[model samples]
Target: MARITYIEHNGTEHVVDVRPGLTVMEGARDNNIPGIDADCGGACACSTCHVYVDPAWVDRLPKKQAVEEDMLDFAYQPDPKRSRLTCQIKVTDAIDGLVVHIPEKQI
Candidate 1:
């Protein structure tokens, strides 16, 4: 399993173990991490799992899909360079220490 860390806007951090094929959103919601409602689960329909990937790790993940790209428009903390839908980020060794930050609120 890969270790994923989510740092909240106020600096609180949540750590969880994730399976290789699971999406980050799944790990968060399943593990009961805060701020990730994942109302649409991992279907890429809701922006509730929106997060900001550390700039250092941004290039290490794949590009978001059109569905994720579109849904991100609903997030309260959208940032073109950093905002991403966590459901679109699959677990991989390259992201074992992956740390994404959740904004204070979601739209």
Candidate 2:
């Protein structure tokens, strides 16, 4: 399991352990972390689960796929270099200390 940190736009932080094989979106949903609406339920069909990866982890995480990249365009105030769809990021030991910042709102 990976211990992921979800930081809200207001600075509130939620740290949770996410099992391997689950997406980061699932981790937040399971732990009741606010800000990740997951409107598409991990299907990568919406940008409600958008987040900005912590700079330190930007290169550590897997590269974003084309679909995720396309969907990010609809996210609220997306940052080209940091924005990602939580639904597209799977949990793993390599990402044990991953940190993601939730945006002020979803689009």
TM-score of each: 0.94, 0.98
lDDT of 2 by residue, 1-107 (tens): 89999999999999999999999999999999999999889999999999999999999999999999999989999999999999999999999999999999998
Candidate 1: misplaced stretches above 4 Å? Answer: none
- Output candidate 1 Cα RMSD: 0.9
lDDT of each: 0.88, 0.96
Return the lDDT, model 2, position 20: 98
User: Candidate 1 versus the native: TM-score?
Assistant: 0.94
| Cα lDDT of model 1 by residue, 1-107, tens digit | 99999998899999889998989999998898888888887788888999999888888889877888899889986998789998899898778999899999877
True-structure lDDT of candidate 1: 0.88
